[model samples]
Target: MIGRRILLAAGVLFGAAAFAQAQIDNGLPGPQPLDAGSMILNRTLFEGIMDRNSKVRSASAKPMPAGGYLSYRASSKVRQKVTREYLARAEKAYGKPIAEGLRKTLGAIDFVATWRRLATRDGLRTGDLGDSVTAYWAVNWLVANGKENSAPGQMQALRRQLGPLMASNPGVRRMSEAARQEVAESLMLDTVVLAIGADTAVQKNDPAVLAKLRTTTNDRFKQAFGIDLTTVTLTNRGLAKR
Candidate 1:
């Protein structure tokens, strides 16, 4: 089983990607509902986070330090503690679901690998059309990743290469905009599906977690993408519905 904290934390960061406003508000179907057990897992993990009498809000509340990679290192200790608790709760609540989600996400398409393969086919790199397309895909991927699974070192390299290209070329900027939007939509849909799945797993033992997940997911979507998912109705008046 995946560490509950890692799973929860990852979900909180990347999973929220499902409902992150930027990803969702493009008039997309927000995060899809998870299976029954997954919802329970999401619910329980969140409850445990909130139950602790500490500085952090619930695991689902958006850890202040773990909100993005930029801030992750700043509060490593606190985040680690939360991560442990989150994993613990997840283990007790949902076993396979937690591990499965991690594997799927961690294994999801490798942007860099695909780019390299495609680039070689086109014979392009560094200050060439191929480079431009690569940068385009990369930026879009980073945005979709939305700070989760975002390795600072990898992002730095990508930025070092593409930053100047976009800054120097108006044509490239214009060319990439549409592609970026399309990628954003794809990511949003993916995120929605994951959130729906996780929420479904943990909604039983932890109502508070369920509620926080709904609010955090909704708010992040609104803030990041400007997409609104009205009210999602679960078996009961679960958070996602509203």
Candidate 2:
């Protein structure tokens, strides 16, 4: 179930592939917040301490162990580098910040740390840095290709289209409210990204380009999680303005 959620979360942002051919793997590696010593302790517990200590609201909180603190700092530096590298690559590929809004959104999210905490709490592995990077690039792709302008409308159209799919899937309906919401949002985001890519292809009258974009998007999602969006029933026409 958690696996499904992760895949859905990832798939939601898959349409960011409309940018140039650069891959997310070209970005820096995922953060390694746990050193050899810290690995001996429960990751959740250690993550809790790190989270509490790192926050401004928790200024009065006790500090993490020296090793944990050092690991956090190291991981943070690497994460920032990954973001910088991704943006630089996008800038070079496109003449400007494509998807500037999306890039800003991604920058605002400390996804590495957030995913680390979430995965640790859920007993999942935490090393899929490429997934997060792909998501960023996907958005960057959208921004670069001018798809960001239509993203909100596309997102809403997708939600309306997905309503029936969500209702029909008992497994989705059975999820906890928070999990369900997350899945819904992720799915919508993925749909929006795909719609933008498809729209770009249509505008350019390039079916081959569309095929490549779809292939790349699916490949990235598959790399992160085994799910493939091509098989999903959601349609690009769903993104059309009503």
Candidate 3:
């Protein structure tokens, strides 16, 4: 369903900007890359994009569409402003030191383009952008770091979490099967982001950020899909290979 949201959202962003190829940073020479650290330390990733999108669309003479992720909406003025505000929020979300490090990393990155890729054609063909990419990064770090054993999961997690909601909301039936599946899967992606974000926060010695992340994440989840993740059991899952 996330893809449908993205596709529908794309109506406003078509012919907007270059879609970036997201990759795990290899410390190699390139335009910019998002490795594990960037993903972890910069937890307000989506918020920043949304802020830019809202700012840009509001600035546009003609009405700009707003259904999905389109942070790369062109607006020279708002780019840096969003970045600055985002960093301030980041400092609040992750502390000053880590935020400073993120700033150094951001220096070389064109985040607008990168954010657009997450919800556009540049997103990998195999899966929707938010879930696939977020899960990959979140799980990659967890599994690679041997935290799979400790990785958190939502009880009736993403997929399971949506079951009741879908049955009640007949409007969801209008969506294609692929879209529904993607939407369900996308919920798990949010869990992964929260899990990884919490883990990162703990490691950074600011364990408090986890609660805030969870609250905000649930709010966003509800706003996006009209389901409340707060009621779900958030524990661990048997994450075996599919």
Best by TM-score: 3
Range of the 10 consecutive residues with the lowest summed lDDT in candidate 1: 63-72
Q: How accurate is candidate 3 locally (lDDT)?
A: 0.32
**lDDT score of residue 109 within candidate 2:** 46
Looking at candidate 2, the ten consecutive residues that score lowest on lDDT are 63-72
How far out, in Å, is residue 96 in model 1?
20
**Candidate 3 weakest lDDT stretch, 10 residues:** 17-26
| Each model's lDDT | 0.31, 0.34, 0.32
Evaluated against the true structure, the overall lDDT of model 1 is: 0.31
True-structure RMSD for candidate 2: 17.6
Best prediction by lDDT: 2
Against the true structure, what is each candidate's TM-score?
Answer: 0.24, 0.29, 0.30
Off by over 4 Å in 2: 2-74, 113-122, 127-213, 218-242
> Can you list the residue pairs that collide in candidate 2?
12-190, 16-138, 98-143, 98-144, 99-143, 99-144
Tell me the number of clashing residue pairs for each predicted model: 39, 6, 4
lDDT (10s digit) by residue, model 2, range 1-242: 01111222333233243332223223212122212112113334423433432342222222222121111122444445545555554555553545453365455444444444322332222332222222332332343233323222222223233233333444533444333223322322333334434444545667566456556655654344333344332122221111
RMSD after CA superposition, every candidate: 19.8, 17.6, 17.4
Return the TM-score for candidate 2, rounded to 2 decimals.
Answer: 0.29
Clashing pairs in 3: 1-179, 1-182, 1-183, 155-233
